[model samples]
Each structure stands twice: as structure tokens, then as C-alpha cells.
Target: MAKDLQERNHLVRWGILIGLSFFSLATIFILIIDFEILRNPDITQDHHFRIALFILVIYFTIYATSGFIRYLARYLNNRYLTRFTALPKLSSYQESFTRSYFPNKPYEHIVILLHGFTASPQEFQFLIKHLEANNIPYISPKIIGFGISSTHLLSLAHRHDWYRVAIEKYDLASSLANKVSIVGHSMGGILATFVAMHRPVHQLILSGPGLHSAPSDLKYKRLLSLPIISSLYIRIVPYLPKPIRKGRQTTSDTLDQTHTGTMFQYLAIPINCVKEVFSAQDDVDITKTQSDQLTIVYGKHDLTVNMSALFQQLDHHNTPYNKMSFNNSAHNVLEDYDKEYCCQYIINLLKNPQKTNPISKLKKQSTTQVQADA
Candidate 1:
């Protein structure tokens, strides 16, 4: 499967290169032919042709230079820059606390809820309540380097750290219940995938999983992978500010309209944290995924991660997963516009693992349909 994916990637690259070469050749031919028809004394002396060639040369030079710099930055970041750490002294905050719901009696199944990077367990507030109402047991724990007042820890924590926390939680859940199910959103989705692969998970529910990043984020991640570039870039700007406190009515007010802005989230995100997320995504293997054990929920308008690429990957691997989508929701479908519908969808999945509901009737869509939705 890996080889097949690699070959497909190579074919795509070659196709792009060949198409560009043909276009360039066609343009050059047209320029020369037009110049001769116009009775130009000499091709070399034609200012119009010289100007066009000059512009094309400059464009290619910039493109080549940028590619070289990107690779150089990645090399330096991997070789030496990884040693640097910017972790902060994380203190316990009320909003960042772990949420665990255990029924009075013994529960047969346990659900592990994992939040996105830089987000807190608060994102699962609605789902938590629904689970409680249904007498379902769940554990929503905060991952390291997130859900805190500072974001510096995100820069220091590697993908392994995040995976360790997930594993620990899964082991604990395994001991407590006979069956385990993991529900992860965003970056947490990737961690859930890792845990599901190694542990005995009964169900794997991923919401807007960060299997592949959006186009803009992909470029930024590639740029930051270069060691020298990452080091120098951090020196200039260590963190990117976030609008966590935006639209707050007062100093003590927490945004109550949604699950967002209800926690002590970081005011800024460490620039280096992008690399950690990229590494986290590397652990996910669509080919290894069991379609029968998977339930996917994603927003059609999600801009944080590349939904199109993710759907394409799953389809390519012939993974016919149970999928649900919201037209209005984005990356935070759990807490976004379709919070109620999303939470209910999850509740139904958990309550009826052995049965399919009307909403889940479309167990899976064809590749063409998935791409069109994306």
C-alpha cells in the first residue's frame, strides 16, 4: 500500500513537470514564430522576445532559490535546532482540568475524548453532557503543551509526548472497561489513530482529523522543517498571537455562547509547534485503518485541514468508513455551528454501535462523491 501511494505521488509529480515543460516549449515556439512572421530582422535583437525570456528566467530563478532555501532550513532544523526548548512552567488551571464521567455502576464500555492541539477538554462539553445523560462513561483528558495559559510548551513537546499521554489514558481505560472507544478531534484525531492501531479499541471516531494539513499550513510546515530557517525564524518571531480573548465582554467573562473561549487557552501559539503537528500526522496510516471500526465526522467547510486530501486518501486505501458531514461546521464541528447535531450524531454512534441509524444510512460514499463534497 505504501509503495502504491508512493508510485502515485511520483506519477503526479512527473505529470506536473511534463505539463509545465510542454507549456514552456509551446510559448517559446509561438514567440519565435510570431517574431519571424512580423519580419523581425533577427530573433536575438527582438526586444519583445528578450523581455519575455528575461521574465521567465527571473521567475524560474526565484522558484529554484526558494526550493533550495526550504530544504536547507529543513536540514538545519533537524540536525541542530531540535535541541532548543521553550517549555514553560505549566500551572493547574480550572478550565484545563481533566473531565471524567463514571457511572454509579460498572460500565461495559469507556470512551476516551481527545481534543485538538492548543485546545482544551472544554471543546467536548456538549458531548460530555450527552454521554452523562445517556449514562455512558467517558474520560476527556488534556494533552500536554495545550489547554494552558502559555503556548510555549507546545514548541518543546514532541509528537512522542502527545502519543505517550494518549497511550497512558488508553491503558487506564482498558483496565476499567471491557470495551474502549476513542473520539478525537483535530490533532487529537491523529493521536487517536495511533492509539487505536496499538490498543484494542472497539470503535475509532475521528472528527475533522488532521490526517493531512490544509494547503497554506502545508507550505508553512515545509518552510519551518528546515533547521536553520526554523532557528532564525524563531529568533525573529518566537510565537504567533491568537485571538483567545477576543470579543470578551469583561475581564472576568468567559465566552458562553460556545465551547470556545471557555478555557485558559494560550494567547499565542509557538511557531515551532507546527512541526510537532506535522510529526503527529505522520503516525496515521489510512491503509491500516479498519473501516468497520471507524466512524468519521467532518465539516464540509473546515479550513484548518485538507478534507479533500483526507477523503481521497481513505478512498484510495479502499477504507469504506462510516462518514457524517455538516455543511456549516468547520474544523471545530463539535463546538461550531452544528454543535447540537454533531453531539447527537456522536451520541447515536456510541449508543448504537451494533446498529446503524437513519443519519448513518449512507455508510460510505464513492470517491467522486467524497471529492465533490470536499
Candidate 2:
């Protein structure tokens, strides 16, 4: 038994050493690319070169230390060394649902669903299932800050930068789909509006949408601006000991069940990104301007968004929009409530163009007056 124990210990030590070495090599490779080591010829006696070397060394030390500490923490906290794992494969139901519902229709209309902050495309899985059932082809791209996408925007400095990239990519993707409709929830809704104003999309749907900073929003903005406070807050927010953030809690009453083995991707979105998005003044007036269609859907029990503020903004914009509300749903109305109804509504819009009038009422009135005068 003593010999067997010694052999196991030897294997564990080797494994940790191997893991640390691999991490160091990967870090070095990334640093080389970031510094453009191969392309830059004037490295000798250059201050930039020296700065890069110093930064690389600091990064290497920090990363190496982190890896070692993490490995030690795992061993000390648990008896077994946990192996790195991949994301879960799509289940039989999910596979069949994807194949059946998202059939490659001549790719006429593209429906882009942008999830809320700290959420992945997984949040829209239920909605996707329903869209598939209705044979509506859709693209649920994981925004830069979430899912498999890069988390560089999660930092306080680049927080809103993700939206610009997201919009550009979304427009490119939509051009292939012919007509595009943007659907966003929470902060994503704010982005959807920004896209609607700038990018050429067929329609817009805002669900429990996030809006620009008001006097009230400044309080949260100030909190996020503090460097140390924001970093610490973000690190702990994902793994909060309680089920809620601040006083805000999901209305689901049931114990906040966590999906095990799921990864929470980090993003470094900054306040400037938010400011830039909010500060943009579009030439198009939503109320006076007619688009394909604009719909704002909210849940009566939504915990994240202030409904009154959202309505006021829409009203001020003079955007010709319809408001739909779910009775007892939270922020995730498409998943927690009537997803089928939402999917069908989207389908009906795609099939019947007349449902969403593109021409302004002012134009119609002018034409009518001209005919009467003639």
C-alpha cells in the first residue's frame, strides 16, 4: 500500500509540472505574437523592445504564479485533481431540434438574438428550440463578452467596445440572410437599437431592453468606474455566495439552481463603450421614421429593466412600435414564458410584410391629399 501511494504521488507531481510547463509555453507563444517579434526588425537598443520584454516577463510571472496557485488550491480544497473538460455536447433532443427547426430555407430573413449581459446563447436555447419547430432559420451569435467568443471587452475600459464589433459582424452575417431582424434583451436591447439606427435591418424587437444612461444609471456607472472595486466585484459576481446581485433577484422563487460544469466566460467591456453607444445621435427618428417593424416586448415581472423608463425613451423617440407584455415572466421572457408565441409572432412577420408597414403615415396622408386635390 505504501509503494502504491508513493507511485500515485509521483504521477501527480509529474502531471502538475507538465501542466505548468505547457501553460508557460502557451503564454510565451501569445506574447511573441502580441509583440510582433518576428516582424519587428529594429529590436536592438529600442525602448519599445525593452518595454515589451519587461511586460512579457511580468505577464509570464503573473500567469505562472496563477497557474501554480490554482493547481495548489484545487489539490488542497479537493482530494482529486480535476482534469480540464470541454463543453457538453448537444443532447439528442437539442440535435434533432436544431436539424428539424433550423432547416436551410433559401435564407431569406435572418433573426439575430443578442443575449443580456453575462449570458450566453445558451440562455436562448429554449427560444431556439421553438424557432426550429416553426422552421425559422436564425443566428444566435455569442456576443464578444459571452460564450465561446473573446472576453477582451469584459474589462472596465472596453465594456461597450463589444457592441461595435458585434454590430459590424452582425451586419455582415445578415447581408447573407437578405432581410435581418434584431432581437435583444437587457444591455443587448440597447445595442439592438443602436444597430437599428445605423445598420440596415428589416425590423427590431426589444425585450426587457437596456437603454442609455439616465441620471439613475450614472450611479451604477460610477460604481463600475472604480478600478479596484469593479475588478473585485466582477470576480465575485459570477460566483456570488447568494443567488442575487445587490437587491436584484430573479423572481423564480425556486432555489437558484446552477447548471454544473458550465463555464462562465469573462469579458472586459469598459464604460467608454457604454458611453459611446449611448452618446450616438442617429439621423433617423424612430417615431417619425418608418421602418419594416419595431416591437418592444417586456415582462410585467421583469427584474432587470425599468419598464417605465424604457417606455418613456421609446415614446420620446417617436418610434412607431407595439408593446407586448408577458404576465408572470422575468427578464428571460422567451425562455421562461411563452416562447412559442414569440416564435410564431416572428414567423408571421417574415411571411406577411404588410403586417409591418415600411412607409411613414405622413407619406400616405400627403399622397391622399394630392389625389383629392387632383
Candidate 3:
């Protein structure tokens, strides 16, 4: 009976895979035909042969590549899940305290590092090393739907669900330290902001918070709100052939190889969730809130979040904060640039709490001071 059950499960898995493969192929065919015949009116009878040849080549390439990509993604995802799920021996220092500042004295503050979308706790491994050296108690939990977190009931609409999850985890971390400082990267930054708004955090550090919206945002919003359209699109588009060369390297690629492999594995997440998290704007009025303790950090060359726009929004909102930009860094500020510098920046914020807004500080120290005095 057990063997029979196992066989049935195997059959089910294969059936799903086969169905998806067929669906993708059909979607590609329809899209290519639709684009060629309906969208392009410039193609005349004289150029039909050339256009047809070009389309065929593009379609075949995309079709073959998509299948290969999906297969690899699935294979890697299974391997990752299996490795993480396996029980391992506990560390000898599981509960042991390391004293750095003073001999036999434990650290007082705890730093909670939150990684961004499609990322795992592994991304913060470097940051963890720095924390250990400083003897700072830190916990980096993989948000649900990412890393080792269960993905059974995961969906794109539930992206903001991390806010509640972070709160629950924060409560657990509070037992370890008198004060908790949260450092969030990308979407994790937005989640951190949600938590900070509700909780009494000592300090809030937002690193490339995924708050900005682009043209694609409008498309997602429309698709997510219309159930019929979204369902049809998902079923058809996943199989359809898209130009792989035109595909941009999203923030997901900047992650460590292992983490990137893990993320691509579960590309089955609902597109709605992706839309909700990426397109959803922060509704909280930072200026009106009494939570004045906040710090914003971003990389100068970040391709994900618009640093300038974010800075402008923060200033317009009159949110009390400090802005720090890493000169040679990308979206993953802590990992991409100097890990030690990022770590030390957090340490400085903890040691000396700055009250003045970062923009105000700059204004106060402007070169006009010398001219005004003259």
C-alpha cells in the first residue's frame, strides 16, 4: 500500500510537469502569432517571408531556453530544500555567550538583520560574521516563502504577511537584548518599516527599501485586481517564449550564488504576490508618527530602488532620519560594498543616536556658511 501511494505521488508530480510544459509551449505560440499578425501592421506581403523566418528563429530559441530554465530551477530548488530540511548536529555554543566589549560581560543590544525579497538568511552571513566579531547578538530569520520557510500556502498577495511574522520574531529576539535595532535590506526594509511603525524599536535602518514604483507597477496593479485576466495571463505567459536577451538582471541576481539558486528554484510563486509587494506603496505617514528613530541607507549605484526619489519623498514627508550612501555599492549595500563599513555604521548609530535629520545636517554644514559670515 505504501509503495502504491509513493507511485501515485510520482505520477501526480509528472502529470503537473507535463501539463505546465504544454501550457508554456501553447502560450508562446499564441503570443508569437498574435504579435506578428495583430500587433505588426507594417509587414507587407513583400516582407512576409523574411519576417516569418525571423519570428520562427526567435520563437524556437525562447521556447527551448524557457523549458531548460524552468527544469534547472526545479532541480536546484529540490536540492536546496532537501539540504536545509535535513536535521544537523547542534553547535556547542548554541547557548554560550561571547563577551567582546568586556570580559565575562555580554552585549546589551541585539541587531536583527532582515533580507529582501527572494533572499534567504544566508545573504546576511557576512553581516553575521561582523556581528559576531563585535559580540552583538543578532538573529537573521528567512522570511516565509523564501529560504527554508515553508511555501505550501505561499502566494504573492501574502507578501506583506512578513510584517506580522517579523513582529512575532522580534518578540522572540527581545528576550535576548534590552534594545532591538532592525536592519532591513530591500523588501525587507519595507517590512522593517511596517514593524518599526508598530513596535518600539531602538533604531530602524532601511537599506534599499523596495518602495519605488515604475511603469511595470501599473501593469501589475491592473493584472492583480482583475482575477480573470490574471488567471488567464499566468496560465498562458509562463509557457510562452519571451526574449531572454532583453530580460534585465533584477536585484535577485546580485545575491550570493547559493541564494540565487535557491530563489530561482521556487519561481512558482503567484505573480500577484510579486505585484503586491513590488508595486504596493507605503501608506504610513512617517512625519506624523511619533517614531522619530529612523535611518536610511542606500548604494550610490543601486539599480533596484531610486535613491534620489526615495530621499526626496522622505524629505517631503518630513520624516526624521539620517541618510548614508555607500560610494561603491549596489542594491545589496552591506554585501556589495564594505561589510565592515556597513557593520561599523550600524554600531555607530547604536552608540551615538543622532537626533537631527540627515538632510538638515547637510544644510547646516553647507559652504554658504563661509559666504554668509563674510
State the lDDT of candidate 3 residue by residue for 75-172, as single tens digits: 65555455343311111121332222323324477778888765677767777776787677887877777774444544533644565567656766
Instruction: List residue ranges in candidate 1 displaced over 4 A.
Output: 1-105, 242-264, 290-292, 360-374
Model 2 Cα lDDT, one tens digit per residue, 209-264: 76634344556556656778865665655321212323344322112223212424
- Model 1 lDDT at residue 187: 86
Q: What is the lDDT of residue 171 in candidate 3?
A: 63
- C-alpha lDDT score of every prediction, in listed order: 0.71, 0.56, 0.60
TM-score ranking, high to low: 1, 3, 2
Question: Candidate 2's C-alpha lDDT?
Answer: 0.56
Candidate closest to the true structure, highest TM-score: 1
Q: TM per model?
A: 0.63, 0.52, 0.57
Report per-prediction Cα RMSD to one decimal. Answer: 17.8, 18.6, 14.3
Single out the weakest 10-residue window by summed lDDT for candidate 2: 86-95
The alpha-carbon deviation from the true structure for residue 239 of candidate 2, after best TM-score superposition, in angstroms, is 11
